[model samples]
Target: MAKQVCMGAMMQCSMGMAPSSLVPTPKTVMTSGVMAANIMDNIPIMNIPPFGMCQSPSNPVVAAATAAALGVLTPMPCVPATPAPWAPGAATVLVCGMPALNDSSKLTCIWGGSISINFAGQVTHDIP
Candidate 1:
């Protein structure tokens, strides 16, 4: 059995500008045999969050290259959006599950990785 791993972060919006929109995009880079069962299990309910939006591209070549490197079955594209008002309170996001070799197998080695959110324009968040 694979032990469940959960990671969470509280991101406070301080864009310094009123009425700004934000689209949270989650990116994951993992070793082969790992699958993402639910990307929204721990994520907060925001106006809009781009989940699995790194597969499509304006150029087919770029998309193909990205797909091959990421080992994704289907490519999902990230769409651009205008910034909206910054809601009060901290925005919470979480990623769950450890990389598993298979349904009945789990990797013993510690997997090293990180998650990041790409925002438009100048913006800062209190995340560590």
Candidate 2:
């Protein structure tokens, strides 16, 4: 990954290097209603191209076992959206942080969580 220093925020990765080819090439940006159109056109199976997640494992075997266990076990606290006293159905809502950028030319990064409660008027669970 190649990074560029722009107006201070360590902007994002400018161009990604191919493992097979060590070419430092320029990336093209398209304004045709798609964010990663140019990058996706050249790469196959590149849904949401040029973006990926890198998981750093503190302990590989432990992490894998924990994930496998979580897949089979049920969640301890399942909080559905509880409705107000007057409302009939439960109303689920999420609160999200502001996006990093509003322009089409820039990337937007947002983070947030969901609000969950039980009908028994207890704030049971939250994960963000």
Candidate 3:
């Protein structure tokens, strides 16, 4: 079973240089002092904060910077471009009428980065 994702959960992006913490909204019931999360909780900077620097060539900022640097790879500040919600969340669990976010769930950035949970924030809450 995967642990339910909650506020302060740690996440890392494939093209990111550092990990960022998940900031779930307060629209759902509390899991363990902090609010639990759902698939739709992914709202870019509001929920999913930046993951340090981004190295994806698909990102316009990085691409432009790299091109300006004479083909040298230039990493820009990571501003996660999550256009959609996390996938493969807890299908058996519901939060705010949506699939509850689980530790094993994955979120994709528009810049071709795979975001994954490094820590689920709490150990007691598990979901199928």
Query: For residues 1-128, could you state the per-residue lDDT of candidate 2 as single tens digits?
Result: 11211111111212211111111112332122222111111221221122122121222433464477874322221111112111111122111211111112222111111111111111225568
Looking at model 2, which ten-residue stretch has the lowest summed lDDT?
A: 112-121
Q: Rate the local accuracy (lDDT) of all candidates.
A: 0.28, 0.20, 0.92
Clashes of each: 5, 0, 0
lDDT of 1 by residue, 8-111 (tens): 22122221111223222333622222222223322323423332233334335435766787955444443223232221212232233322111121111011
Task: Provide TM-scores for the models.
Answer: 0.16, 0.14, 0.93
Ranking by TM-score: 3, 1, 2
- For candidate 3, write residues 26-86 as lDDT tens digits: 7747787789999998899999999999999999999999999999999999988898889
Deviation of model 1 at 82, angstroms: 4.2
CA RMSD for every model?
17.1, 19.9, 3.6
lDDT, residue 109, candidate 2: 18
Backbone clash pairs in model 3 (N, Cα, C under 3 Å; residues 3+ apart or in different chains), count: 0
Superposed by TM-score, candidate 2 places the C-alpha of residue 125 at a distance from the truth, in angstroms, of 52
Q: Model 2, stretches more than 4 Å misplaced?
A: 1-45, 50-53, 56-62, 65-128
Off by over 4 Å in 3: 123-128
